[model samples]
Target chain A: MTAIHTGELVDRIGEAVLADPAVVRLDGGPFQTIATYLPGRRVVGVTAADRITVSVVLRLDQPIPAVAAALRERVRRVAGDLPIDVHVNDLESKEEPV
Target chain B: MVTTNSQNDLRDAVPAARQSPAPARLADENGQGKTTIASNVVQKIAGMAAREVSGVHAMGGGMSRAFGAIKERIPGAGTSSTAGVSVEVGEKQAAIDLDMIVEYGASIADLARAVRRNVITAVERMTGLEVIEVNISVEDVHLPDDNGGDEAPEKSRVE
Candidate 1:
């Protein structure tokens, strides 16, 4: 469960999610997702005191609400015992030339 | 209205639309100038792994640009000098202004917080510098792609 190694859970989750074209396609859409997780995380001192790493970006593009709702639903339908956090933000465009 | 370049005519002028803004040199006589440091730090940290946030758009708004141009036009105004960027420095604490462009749909507060956190993390880890604050100015919000959010990673649970 949550106590398992992060790598193992990441592998399991990645494999499971990548195995499905429908789920993988969810990475598209008009929204963005920032998910974090930690295995063997028992609570060190405060929060994130364990070993948690987030995904690159199930990067989406829509507004905050719709994106958050969809990611929450999709994640629940996709994984088991794997703790994932999805942060959806309606930020300005980062594609501009720097 | 006197129509000068027709849209079709303008479209035909593509061979002349080459934009090559000369690489602006960053020169500062002052030690650890705010603008120079902020630009370098922001660009570098954004390229790092821990940030994961979005990107930096611009430093301030139109006023900053106007002032920048004014400085550039004035004598010793330090235009073209990233050092012209404001800074608050002490024996051990420091803060700088940052220009940034975030991806559409990313949270402003969250992105700022992430930038602050990541920048501070980077500064601490790299320079042993304590970043007390980072003032971020978001310039614009881009249009979402028609296929917008569905182009990246997809997370779902399946055996």
Candidate 2:
């Protein structure tokens, strides 16, 4: 098995999350000023350890709990059984009602 | 020593590969090597299955449905049947996640159960893969006035 790098793993987790329609982007929220800034490669909230943590901004239309659960499953698809921590820092207001 | 073999047996009892189901291969006794079913095929199957259920107004969230609408308006862009359906196909099983807008007055619980049943039956019969789960998210409710009542009712000037 090819070894997975932390940066690459972070990238995958980011991609999996951003690809979901419910997830809008990664926002620092209250952690904005405190987070370290990496110019070229920035997965702002992702931290490497035994598992991964993903914090993001999500659209408010979809249910938050469901979106978080889906994100966990999506991350697992790439990271294997590595546990994930998902934080919803902010919510984008719903633009239109169905 | 014997316990280790038993541990392997336990592992085999619930195959780890089932967790992330991949393309399945059926090996026949004949010289033919194998028959593999791609995951995309399963995704499409599940998408179609979900669409077959009644009370499903649409298949995607706000953004994707908006994009789908735009794509449909374009000259040659056809509407996607797989807008809100996502699947992870494992070797012996598959898991599906769907985002949907249900018509108002429909029982969300009953609708979800129906959709799940349809999806599972369709996928299993077609691919011979066990459907581990069908997770449905009711993103929004499509009310009767949603289509035509773009403008809010004018406020009474004399009230």
Candidate 3:
């Protein structure tokens, strides 16, 4: 496989992770350490180095592990052999009455 | 060489998963990556489950209840669902503590048992965390007479 640019790969991984219904949004973990800084913008919740770290706030409807496993699979599709790390920073109650 | 070495150091400093005193029950680590569930998620689930019991009038101790009341008045300052709940979550198990007010007619012991069961079931089913114990503190009972004024506002106005 052709080597992909780090910035492009990070962006693609972010998109793929968000596509999962169980994910509420990508989260910047405590202290905002889980992120990738690009030239003009930064991708929150995804850092790619020796491994890829993706942090997220998930909807409470699904089991946390199942969602995380699904996310790892999704990231693998774009990230290739890089190990993926999923951090669940928070949970959003989607069904809670306003 | 220096830059690469520093990068490695930085990576090492930040652990792949959060460091907690207790093993995180909801965080599952495997070859692909690690998935961690925050403690607050368990707290919220326990709180919601406790509230679902028929006898539970409200959650939280006196101070928090008062604070919650004030908080509810503010527009967009939503009431906290986790107000009266605290949880200790481990790698494969969780313990919950709850403060609640029961209705006047309900039996406290029975109420506690029902709330415990509901909370354990909800937390286990939703997050897949095993609930080892649920400690419920019945802070107060809601006396029906306390709200009599609201029900008979016209009587007071006429008097």
lDDT of 3 at A93: 69
Question: What does candidate 2's lDDT look like per residue over A1-98, in tens digits?
Answer: 22346667777777888899987786544535312234465567555456456767666445444566677778879878755556565444456211
Model 1 / residue A46 / CA error / Å: 48
Ranking by TM-score: 3, 2, 1
Best-fitting candidate, scored by TM-score: 3
Candidates 2 and 3: which is better by DockQ? Answer: 3
Q: Evaluated with DockQ, which candidate comes out highest?
A: 3
Per-model clash counts, in order, read 40, 5, 4
Candidate closer to the true structure by TM-score (higher is better), 1 or 3: 3
TM-score against native, each model: 0.31, 0.44, 0.76
Docking class of 3: acceptable
Candidate order by DockQ, decreasing, is 3, 2, 1
| Chain A alone, TM-score per model | 0.35, 0.78, 0.89
Model 2, backbone clash pairs (residues 3+ apart or across chains), number: 5
* Model 1 stretches with alpha carbons more than 4 Å out: A1-98, B1-53, B72-85, B99-101, B137-139, B142-159
For model 2 chain A, the run of ten residues with the poorest summed lDDT: A29-38
Off by more than 4 A, model 2: A1-98, B1-31, B67-79, B149-159
CAPRI quality band, candidate 2: incorrect
Q: Which residue pairs collide in model 3, if any?
A: B23-B91, B24-B91, B25-B90, B25-B91
